[model samples]
Target: MSTWKETLFGDPFAVEGDEIDETAQSEAELLAKGNVFEQPAATRGELWGYYLYYNGDNGFTMNSYMPNILQSLAYMGGFYYDGNTTAQNCNNMPEGAVCYVPWAGGSIPVASMLLYIQAIAFSIQFVLFTTFGSLGDYGRWNKWILLSATIIGCASQIIPMVWVNNDGSQWNGMMGMMCIALISYGASLVFYAAAFPLLADNLPVVRKARFDPNVSREDYVLVAEKWRNNVSAISTTFSNVGFLIVTAVLSGASFAPWEKYDFPDGVAHILGNAPIFNYIATVFCGGFWIINAIPYFLWVPAGRGGPQLPPGENHLTIGWKNIISSLREARKLRYLFMYIIAYFIFSDAVNTLNSMIGIIQGQITSFNGTQITILNLVSAVCSIIGCLAFLWIQRWFKIRTKTNLLIIIVLTAIVPIWGSIGIGSTKFGIHNTWELWVFYVWSGIFIAPIWAWQQTMLAELVPKGKENLFFGLFGVVNKASSWIGPVVIGAITQSTSNLWEGWPFVLGLFLIAIVIIFFIDVDKAKEDIRLYLLENSDEASVNGQEKSIHSVHDTDRPVSAKDEKFV
Candidate 1:
């Protein structure tokens, strides 16, 4: 068997079963003698790449631009073209000429247009994800694919700077720019997620002759699990840290001026000035993303390099077939399917809330750009803390994943409830903006832990040897209903001309998710996975070779379909 270094950092161009040179083999042995931990070098590099990727992507998309900067730009666009200048219709706009509709033709509501654009963008992303998601599983060029997608995504981010005009009057191309960016971003993520299991599967086994050679296979499994969890936690923590840093820097620079109060024609106007900040910030974010992705391209291995398709079968054919097969197999894994449903509903609410909060905050509380930045900064800090706390609780207190999820689900229900009530009335004693700030921060504290644990749970439950395909489905579940919440909220806000009314829709989504989650049996789902692997072990071999990392022990354990029971 090859040493870890030879297997991981071996020639990217090398095909499976390629003969190794004698000199290279000798060197691999020499390196293995001094290596203590036996961890794969390529695995370490991928972990670092994962950190940098999240830092750049999450910093720009989730923390800085999507929720904060982009919303401001949309608000400004609406002010200039939406034709709603009345105080009631334009409550979020700053004073003076800021509310003037400069565009000549009849205009749609900003919320409506924004939602339409998002719906279209995500729809395209869903298609692209289906096409590209499984390619990494078959092809040896996954790194090239990933790099191409990232470069395309980065380019899309820069396009908006040119298309979104400063005055918002010439922003007709912004929609197209956003759509392209969203599609590229979504495609990139599919491959990024597919890499996780590949890395996990390729961890170098410790040789018995050298280090703890008598270590049981069960202990190796445990060690692998520890590595997976640590990588997950570290990636999550770094993402939040990166977001916080970016938010602080941008906020401190006062890149965009606060909405200013102005009176014109005896009507108060809340003017949205300094529209150029959006363009500058987005450009900077795009540059940051590309620069940070270099490490990933250089370090992380591409495909698993274990197997390939039969003659005449390429990535496209294999990818589509896998997608269909996975869907069909979902019926056999009913509990896992239910978990996906639960995840869909809750994720929809979470994503919608993330997309619309800046607009909602501006409307309800008149929070300016600086205030929004601060809000995101606070959220980033809280998320980091929450992840660490959850890790600690799980490690030390030994809380079950299901119980922890239930608690988080219950806690998260407070977010939309407080928003709807606080914005609609002072009955909940949330009469002031500071109270709203507190509510937002409280919600942020729970958000990170929920996602961190959710990913861990899914990673645990996914059927072995099918991580790429299942994670692809997970991505679908995540993005599929994602457009629904935004569309519903946007339509409700437009129809009622009241943004506060949309909060109830989000509240309902969360409640439905919470209900569905109660039916998920974590232990039973894990057992089902084990049984499936036991039955299909031979069939799962690639190229007549057993390459699956999911090994079932010979020891007897509970195995029965009837044994499946909800917790």
Candidate 2:
């Protein structure tokens, strides 16, 4: 008769204080009575709008700007220190460089400067995530925060255009611009991720039907799980689509007519002659991001009143407290905590790869702009295929989430190994550019499902109402180690003066993640969250405290029905 018992076993025939009826209702009748098929049209529309816009921005940043920025920095650093002013060498350099290089005497090493910038950006992001992560849980400004961060983040991309000189010789405040842009981009992501749970919970359709009078607790859970899975899959797909579009556009722009067109002095100066395609492509991608993101601000509602703030504490105080509480609670949630550790390790490898791959390709393979664009386009296409395939395999075949993730982790491990050892080594005969292309495309296929699965699993395991707080914790775990990988890799590469050697560190991180993931008990983690919410629901209500619950969307509904009987 306990909550956990009812949840684990079906309670289809049980009614309040009444004997079970042998044939109370057919399964189809029960489903209809519960309104399981009543989709929330408005909610779906909002989700679609937000997902489309957000994913578009995400794609533009990842496919266009992020790579462009990192490559630009590397090229500029080379220009400054080595005085390599070749067309490819100066192609992506920041502005103001034409007026101000050769720094009087000496310049910092490119690798060292890159590592330092990464560290500073991630450190700032960690502080911001710690402070702003829980704002949505307490205040009515979630949407505003998301909007402002996104706008500023997008606007930051334009700074290089204005400040960097066209000639690739000098740029005023180039370092400052890079730092600000990174920080702003990082801040926007925290807000963007924090918004996911809200979107999942607040779908008017799900909220309305979740509390059907005739619905069994098990049935309700089934519905909620379906929604979570559907949303997660769809969101991921949209993100991939966004990446694909950006890649296609950029790749297409590399062709003859566009390549031959003469840009204005300011534009041409920012874009350089080595590969004029990148400059115009970057600006086009930035514009794409800003224009696409408008719908998210317009369509998504923020902070639809849930938990009240604790007495005498504002969101800032509560945000800090939430971080502390999550850390303290980690000991109690062993499986969840372990999973986070695993996520941190693997994520470090993934993040480092994303941030550094362009630099590696440019420096090691001497890839031209056309080649790079084609490579990105192939990767983007593969990513889309991977996401879609994952959804099919999971839904049609019904594989366990942990099992699928492990498979992905193992496959992903192959990439670093291939890159570090197989590519140019005598052992593998993969010495050609086409072979390298195959390896990269293989990597893209495996990497695409990682974020989708990771986010879905975290959503599955997080305590219900405190998504923002836990996601903040997720962000903390993520960003805390973000810079470490880059720093270690950069240090190793610089010390050895070999880019290939640093990649083994990435392979090791992934292997460690695989081992840790093997020990995580997903079912036990979900159970712990359910039990915790059940035990604390009453106390939270009486004390006017905020705690995890079944759904943030259903906060206004009676708790005794769902909390006591279902969750």
Candidate 3:
């Protein structure tokens, strides 16, 4: 066994016993000529930094806190909740409230404004994900790309501290900041997720299994799968831990349980101290994130970078080109695409379900900051617990990645199924305030691990050298359909004046995704990927040639009957 000092990074995958033909192997097998692929165990610090980096990005900016703030602003901007009269949650907006708002115009509900913002942010990120997403693979750009986005995202959160208006007079500016923050956060996540395969690929046990020809490809993949699960779960736990720590301290300090001493005359109104304190809590989360993240960039070796780009290609052009190649490979790479399709649908449903729940949750808590923070605190603790619990359960069951996913998918449906009960009656489902408590605990424990398992599964499916491009596409699929659920839910709530109306649609989506995923052949997918590498190892070079991709796509290999469904 290699010691911690051993450089376990980016050593190319080589078969020791097989008499392999040089002609059959792409020179571009996982690493480029003379690229440094060696990093020691200290890289855990790097992973830790990257995971903790999400605190401000996801924990603060994209969490329920932002929605609560936005909805609060909306109420101030003239959207109120009246039990007797409200618009499709909107159509009945009180005469005193502003029924029509800007950006899309017409009689849009005030509460739904944030949903449209969610959609538009994803719309922008779709462009970013497709454009710059592949750039990280060609050089040591992944580190810098993540850092740059992290700064922008954190700034977008902290910058808002300067503007605090109880009347929501700064609503437009706040909306702009939210879009910027969400887009930046989404991009950072894509780049961050793209690193998982690299880390898993480089683990000592995996590296040994990878190079040992006696270890069957299936056996090697098993090693890789275990490490992938470990890395994803630990990293996710670290993220939620960061969320736990920062949210707890900040919210506590902001609320100030002790009786307040009045500020000296005129200072009370300066920077609108109360709102500023809350906003500063958000800023504190960002600062803590940057502090934890700084060490990773300063050290930690980068793993395999794919083949060098062709002379004329730049970061912007390479991603779009690679993505096009990936789409063309859809027929041949059947199981991967099947998973992607299932992911596309279920993720859409889940994202929408989350948004609907957040809307109702805010109503249950009356959009109170302390209440929201407490829920977040509870969620953070449960999220960490969930990730750890998942790893324990997986180890105990000795399950495959697909089996783990099936479990998560089935359990995740419970959220929407229960929420849908509200469609028929207000007495049960997500109607009561207590359900919000249950929602936080339930989702934190079940749904949070879905991300860990899903990412682990994708790491299993993606071709070795093309992790960045495939992960980028993973992000594109996520962003591409994310807006659908939010937009549809917004319209549903607008038409019905009831938020519960959208749960059934989300439940149906969950059912469809579950069915599709259940039928997917994970074993077939693994075998296909194994064969794919042998056939197209040469084409995997990062030279950015369109013809090479076309050739890969046009392989003379024939597809069999059962595999035809994958195609």
**Worst 10 contiguous positions by lDDT, candidate 1:** 558-567
Against the true structure, whose TM-score is highest? Answer: 3
> Could you estimate the TM-score for every candidate?
0.73, 0.73, 0.73
RMSD of 3: 8.9
- The lowest-lDDT stretch of 10 consecutive residues in candidate 2 is 558-567
As a whole number from 0 to 100, the lDDT of residue 339 in candidate 1 is 80
Stretches off by above 4 angstroms in model 2 are: 1-48, 62-66, 73-108, 163-165, 171-175, 196-204, 210-232, 258-274, 299-308, 364-367, 390-399, 422-432, 456-471, 521-548, 553-567
- Per model, how many backbone clashes are there? 8, 11, 8
Candidate 3 residues lying further than 4 Å off, grouped into runs, are 1-58, 80-103, 139-147, 191-237, 258-277, 296-308, 398-400, 459-469, 526-567
At residue 2, give the lDDT of candidate 2.
41
lDDT of 3 by residue, 81-142 (tens): 45655532232444433333444555566546767888888788888877877665556677
Against the unseen true structure, what C-alpha lDDT does each candidate score? 0.58, 0.59, 0.64
User: Please, what are the lDDT tens digits per residue for candidate 2 over residues 206-255?
Assistant: 44444444656556655555555456546555655666777677666565
Off by over 4 Å in 1: 1-50, 59-107, 163-165, 195-232, 255-275, 298-307, 310-313, 362-367, 394-397, 422-432, 459-469, 523-567
